[model samples]
Target: MIQIKDLHKSYHMGANSLHVLKGINFDVKEGELVSIMGSSGSGKSTLLNILGMLDEADEGSYTLDNVPIKNLNEKIAANYRNKFLGFIFQSFNLINYKSALDNVALPLYYQGVNRKERVEKAMHYLDKVGLAPWSHHLPNELSGGQKQRVAIARALASDPKVLLADEPTGALDTKTSHEVMELIQGINDDGKTILIVTHEHDIAKMTKRIVNLKDGVIIDDNFVQQVRATQYV
Candidate 1:
């Protein structure tokens, strides 16, 4: 679960001041699948970054599960992110030479998880994403869908509470995108909060709730009574 109130982010471009988020307020409940949709320069990605603590806001407050992210020390925040948050990006962010398993295990390595236990957990997640057979393959060795699956595997390897996916299906074809969404749905079914940022209507429809942002502010918010996913099986 996460909550943001009066959140603001700004950047300086020479003499001009650019505001990315302007006092946005939103709350994501635990085990809910939500989407944030916006067009170019709408600050959806900036909001995601701020929510995930990768970027700081100039004003307002953020709380994850009950702890205030801005109130924590840098080291403590890093530890909390490692322990509770999973991030899926448009770029996949895989290491070029590392095998799928190795890349998925990278976060665990940073947390000092022992090799055997870390690798075992990584492989478990890889299999969950249907990439068990590709565990030894490198990023370049996999196709678009396969690469995304590996990325999802990496995100789940840590058993994170919430998954922040920014344009998660951006790099794949329609079929592959559905496949990835189904996998994410499965994750949500297992009780992980999922916040997806996308511009695609179909992608937004798959979620339980949708929030539209423009000019760094939420313009509309809708919650679907019935949850719809790309796949149930």
Candidate 2:
């Protein structure tokens, strides 16, 4: 579902350039759950940004669902991001003033989904995330887990080709983190391809495969025995 070969990126500050993602190569098949793990400056975030089409690689090739992702115009990139990728962030990234329902409906709103269908689709996903009863609650009114669930629902509302989560369980307590992972595992079981970027070992173990990055390159990529999040939850 996703492919990357010889990916490279760099950030320039004045005369010096800090190279990131030196020669990354990987592929994610449809319905697979994978985690990208790395320490600080390991380029996991850079890789994620490139995978999400939020940033362009300085070199190499990326193909998402067979569509080349190099040098896309801003308008085309934004459209592809909307149509092909869904994002779940550690911070939840919800608008505090908006109710959970409204927050979930925001993407659909941008997609030009009509009001009636938007409401219907939003409610359906909120319910799917077990947040239907709290749909009217604002982000500030919900717990950390609830807010993240709302974010997940928002990501899922569009049914994108893949879900890219950045430190998805980073901010929550252990139990809550496990609960969120359990939900994520269930989603993957239903055949949604997911790629998560996280620093936590336990969290990475929950995924079917782990790709370890160091100094801008993939050091290891292998499928491990999947650890079900339910055990921890």
Candidate 3:
């Protein structure tokens, strides 16, 4: 479902250039759950940004669902991003004033879904995430796990082909983190291609495959027996 080959990225600050990703190569199949694991400065974030089409690579190729992602105009890139990918961030990224239902509805709003269908789809996903009863609560009114659940619902509301999560369980307590991972695992079970960028070993273990990055390159990529998040939850 996703492919990258010889990917390279760099940032220039004054006379010096910081190389973020070097010769990265990987592929994610349609029903796989994978984690990109790395320490700070190991280029996981750069890789995620490139995969999400939030940033462009300085070199190499990326193809998402067989569509080549290179040199596209901003309009087309944004359109592909919206049509094929969904994102979950550690920060949740919800508007402070928007209620959980409205927050989940925001993506559909951008896609020009009408009010009735937007609310219907939003509520459906919120209920899927077990947050239907709290739909009227704002981000400030919910716990960290609840807020993340809302974010997950928002990410899924559009039914995108790929789900990209950055440090999805970073801010929560262990139990809550496990709970969130369980939810993610459930989503992957239903055949959603999911990629998680996280540094935590336990978190990476929750995924079916772990790709370890170091010094801007993939050092190891291995599929393991998936650990059940419910055991920890």
Candidate 4:
């Protein structure tokens, strides 16, 4: 469902240029759950940003669902991003004042879904994430795991083709992280194409495949027997 070849990215600071991704190549098929694993400065975030269309690569090709993702105008890029991708960040990026239901409904609002359908869909997702009871609570009113569940519901409300999660379990305690991963695994089992960018070995192991990155390149990519997060949760 997603493909990249010879991807390269760099950033310039003053006279020096820092190359973040060098010759990266990979593909993710539908119904696969993959994790991109790397340490600090390993270019994982750069790769995720490119995949999410939040940033452009300096070189190489990216095709999402067969659509070329290069040199597109901002308007078209945003449209494609909305239509094909859902993003979950390390930081729960919910608005402090918005209730969980409203936050989940926000994306549908942009997609021009009417109020009735938006609320119904938002509630559906919130219930899917086991947060229907907390729908009226604001972010600050929820615990970290609860907030992340709200974020997950928000991401899923649109039913995008692929789910991109960057350090999805990074901010939670071990138990909470395991609980979140269990939820993520359940989502993947239901056939969502999920890609997780994380440094934690245990977290990476939860995925069906692990692609290790080092110094801006993929060092290893292989599928392994999946480890159920419920074991730890």
Best by TM-score: 2
- Rate residue 132 of model 3 by lDDT: 99
Summarize candidate 3's per-residue lDDT along 52-129 as a digit string, tens digits: 999999999999999999998889888888899999999999999999999999989889999999999999999999
Clashes of each: 0, 0, 0, 0
Q: Is candidate 3 or 4 superior in lDDT? A: 3
TM for candidate 2 is: 0.99
- lDDT of candidate 4 over 212-231, digit per residue (tens): 99999999999999999989
User: What pairs collide in candidate 4?
Assistant: none
Candidate 1: stretches off by over 4 Å:
71-74, 225-233
Q: CA lDDT, every prediction?
A: 0.88, 0.95, 0.95, 0.94
Q: If both were scored by lDDT, which would come out higher, candidate 1 or candidate 2?
A: 2
Clashing pairs in 2: none
> For each candidate, what TM-score against the reference?
0.94, 0.99, 0.98, 0.98
Q: State the weakest 10-residue window (summed lDDT) of model 3.
A: 72-81
- State how far residue 131 of model 2 sits from its true place (Å): 0.6
Candidate 4's C-alpha runs over 4 A off are none
The runs of at least 3 residues in candidate 2 whose Cα sits more than 4 Å from the true structure, single-residue gaps closed, are none
